[model samples]
Target: MAMTQTQRYGVFAALALVMAATRIHLSLFHHDIWDASWGIFFLAGFWLRGSARWAFPLLMAEAVLIDYIVITNMGISFWSHYCVSAGYWFLIPAYGSLWMGGSWLAKRQRGLTLSTLGMAVAVLLVSEAACYVISNGSFYWLSSHVPTPKSFTAWFANLGDWYLPFLQTTALYAGLGAVLHVLTVQMARTSEHHGQMQN
Candidate 1:
């Protein structure tokens, strides 16, 4: 079912709110919930598939703004924050990987069948892996934060240490998103069926 303009707007707002609410790790509202920034981007991609020209940039801006506010709130300049570095810019492509993954899944999603679920999981794995490589690998190799004398062995170890945690967090949110997607699709189908019966 095609979404109305209002529905799209509503989804956009909800995603933005989720990002704001969870992105700030130190915020009182956060309660230490794992950051959903990565998953949010994927969800946005799935839901807002063709809106990348604008939606992606808007969400990206919001992420950066939230980071700025959080870092500056801690009495440090945003630029001086440990996470801010040359490698930070790589997030565009990293998040884009998730968005593309979501868009890819959206295009192929047929129903709540096992095949669909399998495809979703497969897409998530590949996309998240790509995202991790770009985000983590860049940070390890290019960011000034990492100690000097980087090696493939060291980076591989670093990847092993953090990859699962990142993937788990993303999967958790993606799972919720998937459930929501299924519910919406089911509801729409029911509504249409009812309409046809009435005719």
Candidate 2:
């Protein structure tokens, strides 16, 4: 039951659309309490299948589109709104690397549950670190609009303001992502077993 080229393309295209929609929906509707974007799902999909070249581009495009829509609707400047979107190119690779590493660990560990948890945490930490460093540096050094913090104390305070919410969001999303990965793997195993029994 090997997938044909057409089938593979279809799968990739469908997943890309789904990822885009999920990201836009989450960004718009799920802004309170916790934000659940296609980021985790993209990472999980890449983990399960390997490279997510299409997924990453689709995710970034969706983010940019959402930024435009939000800006137009809210009467905000598009540049200001899209500043966050600009970081996705760097952030996606950081998380994607972690996902790939996690997938390797899962393969090596013979499908242990703990391996999945470790992968999720690894993804979270890598993503947060990459985003924090890149985004903060851009704000401080590159961007003229964002006021650079004057002192070390001010910079540290700014870092806390940027990092804390990100940490909380990543923790919540990573926990959910671990659970989802486990459930998906379990279901896949169950289906395979059932198919074998039928055969």
Candidate 3:
């Protein structure tokens, strides 16, 4: 029941590695403008359970790995990509902490009626704010270098076009994340119940 420090470290390390691998694979093959990938889920997981000291370093390493691959293979600028990628990690603590807190509140309330909604909203706002700031800022910087539509309004409009799609995708991911969390909690409860029955 009680995890040793080494066990915890190993678990965290394995999770981080799997997260990095999945993100890299998705970036290489299945990534699209509208598709949210495992990276988001990984951050959500870390936020839900991981310590900031552990999660931040893992996130930074993952970001650096992905940036190197993207720059080498896709010809994207590493600096710009790093800027945006770094933002995801920056936002993870706030977003994740809120979600974790919301879940705790829901537990105290003994239902998912009002508490769930509050938590969901909190998660959404944190996610959206992070996405908006990072994506928009990255796009703005990249736009200056590339041939984008000429005008702040047009630039934002284009950004909006991409933003809405990804937001939708993130919402879907959030829903999935919530379901996974619930399932995990249920399984733990069931296991505890079984252990009690045996005793």
| Stretches of candidate 3 exceeding 4 Å from the true structure | 1-18, 30-50, 74-114, 146-151
* lDDT tens digits, residue span 1-199, model 1: 4778789889999999988888876353555698888899999999998889988999999998898888888899888778888898999999999999999998998877899899999999999999999999988888888998999999999999999989999999999988898899999899999999999
Candidate 2: 10-residue stretch with minimal lDDT? 35-44
Whole-model Cα lDDT per candidate? Answer: 0.90, 0.55, 0.54
Model 1 segments more than 4 A misplaced: 25-31
Clashing pairs in 3: none
Candidate number that wins on TM-score, 1 or 2:
1
- Candidate 3 matches the true fold with a TM-score of 0.64
What's each prediction's TM-score?
A: 0.94, 0.67, 0.64
Positional deviation of residue 32's Cα in model 3 after best superposition, in angstroms: 6.8
RMSD of each: 1.6, 4.4, 5.1
lDDT of 2 at 97: 50
